[model samples]
Target: MIKIKIISSKETYSVRQPVLRAGKPIESCLFDGDDLETTKHFGLYFDENLVGVVSVFENKSNNFHDEYQMQIRGMAVLEEYQKKGLGNFLINQTEEYAKFQNASLLWFNARETAVAFYEKLNYTIIGSAFEIQNIGIHYVMYKHL
Candidate 1:
């Protein structure tokens, strides 16, 4: 059985480090606003082990004029768990939570490879592709709630 629930920012680092920052240090997973009062992290647990994680921040983008918006960061699922629908499950849960928080939209800097994945989920790409210093190319993707 898969269970999804709110988890601490610290707890999310375990999955985030391994899945999102493989060669980098564990500290790389510690994102800004991760410990903020309004920030929320979701964990996907299969049986008792956490297999996927995503962090959402209550932030408004200049590109979006919406009063309330949320940014998804460090979304990752374990390599072995990739094609099992856990990613979609985590995203659906995040959208529900964002709606509950009164956010009008959700956005994220998705990796270029994941653009099609987000598109399939109804998120549209905005602006040109850009690099994130250490990371490769990424596209800004968003979905209106």
Candidate 2:
């Protein structure tokens, strides 16, 4: 059976290794110096092996809506673990974490290929596609919680 849980110190290694192996350089998006000290992250495990993970961060903007929106980053599911609902589990955990932080909306820079996946979860694209260095086309997707 699959289980979802908050990321703990002991479980960090399991999650990080898979993310790095996914070839996405999750660390750059995850750490962000200050955020490493403040943001919350979660992972999904299948019988003690971490198979998926997601990270939540407060929007680093002074804009009025910043308080109401939380940014999701570094979401990944291992190759062998895809299409098994683990992504849904991690997304659910991220949303719950955002709600706990009193955020009303969840947002992310989702890769073009993953846009449909987020859309299925009720996330709507807000604007045109943009590119991040080394990262392919992406769109800003948001979901109201």
Candidate 3:
């Protein structure tokens, strides 16, 4: 069985390590030294072991802009935990939280390999693919809340 929860500071390190291992040199902004200043992090647990993690953050805009959107970042499922629907669960939870925050949309720079996965979750790509060192090809995908 699996459980998902909002993580507090004390557990942030534990929750973040797996994502770091998964992304390696491309550690997402969520793993940055000042992550807490910009993102809300969450974790997925399998029988008491941390198995996946994701970061959610508000989109930056011009001082006068009032648009509201949330981006999902640093999403990863441990190698042993992949292909079991945990990724979908994490995305669902993230979207639910985005809605709770009154976000109009959910967006992410999804890895190319993950395009179909996000597509299955109903996220649509808005442009051409791009590359991020150590992170493979990526596309800007979004879904309305």
Candidate 4:
């Protein structure tokens, strides 16, 4: 059975380390606001095993005008779980949660490779591409809620 639900910040490290942080140190999986009161960590479970994760922070980006905005960070699914609609499920669930919280916009810095995936969900690029050290090219993407 597959399930999606809110998870603790620590619960996300297992998937984040292997998928998002890759060869980097485990400490790299610890995002800046992972423990913040306003942040929420979500997990995708497969037959009782954690296989995917995404985190959202109540962060505002100057590029957008929405008073209530949430930034998505550390969205990842294990290599074995990719292309199985698990990512879509995770993201859709997160969007619903964000709407419930009164967030009018959702944004994130998406890696070049995953830009297409995000585009499929109606997220559009906001500005020119940029590079994040050790993370290659990225584009700032956002969607109005």
Candidate 5:
């Protein structure tokens, strides 16, 4: 069985490094605000091994008028576990957490390749695509709670 639960920012680095950073150093997986008191990290465990990870931060975007907003960062699932509904499950849990925190919306700089995935979840793209150094193109995507 697969279980999704809250985990420490440090714990998320394992999956984040391998799946998101890939060729980059493990330290690159450490995102800003990851250890903040209001930040939350989630891990997807299959049996006893973590296979996916995601982190959310209490961040506000000028593009959004919501009083409370959350940003999702460093979301990644193991390659072998991709397309098995795990991504959807993680996202659903994150949305619930956001709502619990009184956040009216959730946003993220989603990679260009993942745009369709977020769109399928009812998130709309904002502004044009842009590059982030070594990372490929990305677009700001958001969903209102």
Candidate 6:
């Protein structure tokens, strides 16, 4: 069985390092607002071991005029767990959590390769893809709550 639970930011670093920041500095796993009271990190456990993770911040982008917004950052599942629909479950859980906070919209900088995955979840790309320093191309995607 798989379980989703609210985990600390530090707990997410373990998965983030290998999946999202592989070959990069460990500092790359640390994100702004990660420790904020409004921020939340979630972990998905398969059986008794954590296998996937995602972090959400109560941050609003100037590009969006929503009264309340949240941004998703560092969402990833272990390579061994890919193609098992775990990502969809993790994202959907985060969306429900955002709604409880009265969020009007949810946005994130999605990697180019992950665009289709977000699209399948009904998230639309805002503008053209842009580069994020060390990271590759990314597009701003959002979904209305």
User: Candidates' lDDT values, in order?
Assistant: 0.92, 0.74, 0.75, 0.95, 0.92, 0.94
Better of 1 and 4 by lDDT: 4
**Per-residue lDDT of candidate 1, residues 1-145 (tens digit):** 9999899998998898887788899888899999999999999999989999999999888889999999999899999999888899999999999999989999999999888878989999999999998878999999999
Candidate 4 lDDT over residue span 90-145, tens digit each: 99988998999999999999999999999999999998999999979999999998
Model 3, 1-145: lDDT tens per residue? 8998876533545545554435443233334432566567788999989888887888742321337988787777877888899999999999999888898888888888889989999989887898988657888888888
- lDDT preference between candidates 1 and 3, better one: 1
Give the per-residue lDDT digits (tens) of candidate 5, residues 1-145.
Answer: 9999899999998898888788998889888898999999999999899999989999999988989999999889999998888999899999999999899999999999899888999999999999999988999999999
CA RMSD of each candidate after superposition: 0.7, 3.1, 3.6, 0.7, 0.7, 0.8
- Cα lDDT of model 2 by residue, 1-145, tens digit: 7887777433444565564334555454344632455577677889878888777777743322655778887788877888877899889888877888789888888899898899899999887899987667888888878
1-145: candidate 6 lDDT, tens digit per residue: 9999999998998899998899988888999999999899999999978899999998989889998999999999999998899999999999999999899999999999899999999999998989998878999999999
The residue pairs found clashing in candidate 1 are: none
Q: Report the Cα lDDT for residue 20, model 2.
A: 39
Ten residues in sequence with the least summed lDDT for candidate 6 = 19-28
Q: TM-scores for all candidates?
A: 0.97, 0.81, 0.81, 0.98, 0.97, 0.97
Clashing residue pairs in candidate 3 (N, C-alpha, C atoms within 3 angstroms): none
Q: Judge candidate 4 against the unseen true structure and give its global Cα lDDT, from 0 to 1.
A: 0.95
lDDT of 5: 0.92
lDDT of 1: 0.92
Candidate 3 lDDT at 120 equals 92
Q: Candidate 3: deviation at residue 116, Å? A: 0.8
Model 4 stretches with alpha carbons more than 4 Å out = none
Candidate 6 residue 89 C-alpha distance from true site, Å: 0.8
Candidate 3, run of 10 with poorest lDDT: 25-34
